[model samples]
Target: MSTDVEINLLDNRWDASVASGMSESELLLYRSNVLGSDKRVTNYGGGNTSAKVLEIDPLTGEATEVLWVKGSGGDIGSIKMDGFATLYMDKLQALKSLYRGVEFEDEMVGYLPHCTFKLNPRAASIDTPLHAYVPRKHVDHVHADAIIAIAASKNSKDLTQEIFGDKIGWLPWKKPGYELGLWLDKFCRENPDADGVVLESHGLFTWADDAKACYDMTINVINQATEWLAQKSEGVAVFGGAKHESLDVDARRAVAASLMPAIRGFVGGNQHMVGHFNDSDAVLEFVNSQNMEPLAALGTSCPDHFLRTKIRPLVVDFDPAKGNLDEVMEGLPAQIATYRDDYAAYYERCKHDNSPALRDPNAVVYLVPGVGMITFAKDKATARIGGEFYVNAINVMRGASAVSEYVGLPEQEAFDIEYWLLEEAKLQRMPKPKSLAGRVALVTGGAGGIGTATAIKYLSEGACVMLVDINADGLATTVEALAAQFGGDVVRSVEMNVTDEGAVAAAMAETSVEFGGLDILVSNAGIASSAPVEETSLALWSKNLDILSTGYFLVSREAFKLMRVQDMGGAIVFVASKNGLAASPNASAYCTAKASEIHLARCLALEGAEGGIRVNVVNPDAVLRGSKIWEGEWLDQRAGTYGTDKEGLEEMYRQRSMLKRSVLPEDIAEAAFFLASDLSAKSTGNIINVDAGNKEAFTR
Candidate 1:
């Protein structure tokens, strides 16, 4: 549930012309659209809205007063004078100094009796403290369909981070009452200047000194989210249907006009496209779905849905020869069948042998060929949101056709995204980085120094990171350190040898559930071997491949499955040693495995691109993590073979770099962060340098 609104929330605004001594220009009527939009963004009883209403404080006997927020059940478009709530400005500010996030829902509501409470319009917005938390006169909180849909996606966190940066804090979904108020209280205290708040698995909050700023920010957030969503969507050329779609200006306007009547007629007047699904592929594929209801689940992803078409849209897939209504009337049953069949197939493909699958799709929409597909929801706004969503789903489905091996989310994983309380909780705790929130990220050998650093970075960026390693104590230590900071839910640690397939799969599955789905995976776990060619036994060769190469594949396979189903792009990075790109004598086993990783990243990068999954490799040269690189048997062995002192051997490594400074684990962590951030949004299938300049000396 969200309290934000779409553009038309002002359509039925109450007239204030009768009031005397007040300027009509400054009255809320001037900002009618904004007030109305505040109510259009959320679900049934989902969000709250408010406005500043001038009143005299009877106690102080002052000439002027404070903000009057919307009461419970007050629709923005139809709000009356009594619907606005009165809040003493000085008192509200006083509450801010408490430095706590506890909600005063009842406490605040209870205070109404003290000041013009009876004359006060409606009950105050449930989020009065939150609204008061904002230093703005106008405040809105709504579950916007576009933003929430993005929030609901696996990449929403990652994408949101990229789009919004630190400007907004992500509150993982928590129930929207007192507890969430505490969460917001904490967040506001931390980020005093944020213009908004993004509720993970929920909606968005936008406020301003004036109603217009509040309104525009709402539109801006949705529009930005819509464009970002478009880019992130799995889009492709149309297939198995009409190939030519060249309707010029007149035709385009005509189509929009034609659809308006039907859409408006069914829902009510004032219907509009808050954000339209206009891509050719999206429009084409969705219009051609065998069953529109199943296709409709993709329509609207979050709370703003109720504003669009209520909760979900009804499908009209069959021929509408007797006008569109005849077909819509008849296609309902078939649409349900198609939706059921698709869900069943998805369940069968992703089901583990143990669990029984649920029957209903999280949401649904549909239609027969030729006739336009309808997005069904309980409201107009959600229906419109659904229109774009189902189209994106179709585009991904078709693009996956090229790979012929594309798979959807597993039943349990899908269930997790649609209903994970923990995920919702994450929105409350972490700043939702549209880029990485709700994503399951794995860092191999996470117990090892470098792996631990990578795991921590991802967790900080709002990802569910599973740190894996063979050393039980090391894993415990890493987990303890990370959990203390990111919380136990955001960071998980597992002790398992990467070489075992069953062990790897179980670990991946367990980690995936804890985090929701896999998105960013870093394969940094590997054992090093320095035996010469002649001394390298067949046993050693097999062992190296087992722990290094085979291990990489096992982790990669499961990660690929999780990413593919979510339909959100994923990133996989292999921490191959510099030896893979160059040469190292007496290091046959280690070099082979390292080399294999480079090749694997390349091949997978090429193959997975169609699915929007990016693959890259990090070549780190002699990075120290309290390891023997600085002073120990490892460096001693190399120095002895080179007939040089420890200083001489260390210089040998540094000379290979341009900077001549030893690479530290922190340096590698920074590089990993770049590859995983928007800083390199367009990069993939590439190798990044974590080395000084080793490539210049050794060109292997």
Candidate 2:
């Protein structure tokens, strides 16, 4: 092996003091978490780790050896003690006696539950048998990119020998199941001195009689392979050298922002898809390379990679040298259509008699030359994770193609893995998606009570939200709180003044790039001013009109432009006020501005009807609690006007309502949720009064 390459290698993170105190099972969890923390070791949900421990059998009152392994669909990086499935070692070994042949191996999964120890409810993954029959106290199966680079080469066996000598063994490709598990046991029996093996077009498996030893061996083996590949491939041109120069960072992002929404529209024919954009150095290098199309066409080599990213990505016909984004936009629909047809053809050519009915044929990953990669999926995190996996594949291809011919998994093999009956069964067990699972929303004035409440409601129902506010500090606090509740992936914030035309347009672009596109806009940014007609200053009147009427128009106009590009109908909910309809004695400017907001919704409804866009109004009255406006001078002014103090103002408003109930931010949120959801799909240009029975604001 060459020694010229000097690169950052994987660090051995096992602290002796820490490991000395942990129990055997806790050590397994600790080892798995550390390995999973770095994508260089394994991609998310792409590996399994296990340890055999002695436990008292609940049924027989005797000490027995049990296997503790990661459960199905659990990510090692975030898994807890409950995430592991425990099974009796004797039963798992005895399963070999029941296995008839490779063809009937899938039936073995049905018996895993029967082997459960202590009635642990976690379902064992298909990889359980591979770990079980290894004949070692600890085992780790990880899809490391370095090992896969060697595994995916045309002469992978030769490369494996050149890198690790006799320390690690090799096995040919076999779809992971009971049969593959037996193959591993047989390999271990034959190669007694070997510490691990690399599976062709699969992943790496390492074992040790000690828990820490297994982790050390796993990390050491991967590091060795990575260093060797780097040395052998040093000074080699990546992806056959770049075919197109990379666009400047700003231009690349602009191109991605332009293409994402249109592509989202085409692929979202069945269900809405959130988008993720990646312009990292690796992604830029690959996308701007000469071999990008051919390598992408080969699809991913690992089953885990293809399972997240579809079989292959769709290569967009974009050239940064020409800078013809408009032309690219015009051709996106046709390009997307061709991709679907090709995917369908692949399914038809490789499918078996019992393959699951054809799934959504749309491509998950999209490659734009000279810009970056765009991925669309059912939700934001999935889309972003899919991009990360593709980047991993890019790394593998770069290393493999540099030293040896990079090879993809056979088309039939990839199809079998994707459409396997076992995989299909797992898919069927997933929970139904939430009502707004794939939708994205932007709430203006999101730092305030009503805006924050509306965002929380949308996020609860599975929508990605972009919170827009002018208060920098408040926006940051609100974003931090929401991110804590709903993860940072689904919540984003932008400080923007809705009245500025330029700010409104930039916010729209940011939303497109942030979450693919927009599906709902809750126009809730406003201020409350209480002054008699004589006392109201020109400045106060202009402020109300500027923020309430003109601001709403600017935001809606930009939203319409973006939604039109997506060609998917959207919802626009205007949070007007009950005072817009009921004339108050001391607040002409506030009432007139709000009335303008209500009328704007009516006009937008008339114009957006043909495009399937629905516009509606939610009129709220005396929302005193949890409202930023009510916390300021507006509270004192309103209390003075009604002859009540701050303490009694809420009760005064409650008694004035016909239903004698106080209005809160949550009430407005619920109303906004209805208008934005399918519950009000058929109703447009309508008003839902959430004032606890305000006759003056009634929309009859």
lDDT of 2 by residue, 1-700 (tens): 1223457689998888878889989999998998899889999999899999999998889999999999999888888999999999999988888998988989999999999999999999999999999989999999999999999999999999989899899999999888899999999999989999999988899999999899999999999998898888887878888898889987887888889899999989889999999999889889988898999999899899999998899999998999989898888888989998999999999989999999999999999988999999999999999999999899889888988988999999999999999999998998999999999999998999999999999999999999999999999999999999999999999999988999888888888888899999999998999989999999999999999999999999999988999999999999999988888879999999999999999999999988889999999999877778887799999999999899999998899899999999999999999999999999899988899887877777
Angstrom error at residue 636, model 2: 1.7
lDDT of 1 by residue, 1-700 (tens): 1112222222333334533344322344334334454433443445566556556667667645475665655555555555556767666655545433433333444444343333554445445666655555666776555566555555556656777887766777664444466577677778878877887656788767665566667767766765554454334232333423334433433333234223322222111111122325346444544433443444333433322232344444334233354455444446555655665665566555534434334223433344344443322234444654444344333333222222333334454333334323433454434445444578888887788778767776666677888888878987998888876546777777888887787676555333334568888887666666998899989988987788898888877876664556678888887888777888778788888988888889998899888888888887754442234555666677667887776677687577888887777877787776666768888888788886542434
**Whole-model Cα lDDT of every candidate shown, in order:** 0.58, 0.92
Candidate 1, number of clashes: 90
RMSD of each predicted structure:
22.1, 1.6
**Positional deviation of 176 in candidate 1, in angstroms?**
13
Model 1 segments beyond 4 Å from truth?
1-434, 627-636, 643-652, 696-700
Instruction: Find the 10 residues in a row with the least total lDDT in model 1.
Output: 268-277
- Candidate 2, overall lDDT? 0.92
For model 1, what is the error of residue 174's alpha carbon versus the real structure, in angstroms, after optimal superposition?
23
Best by TM-score: 2
Poorest stretch of ten by lDDT in candidate 2: 1-10
Candidate 2: where is the Cα deviation over 4 Å? 1-6
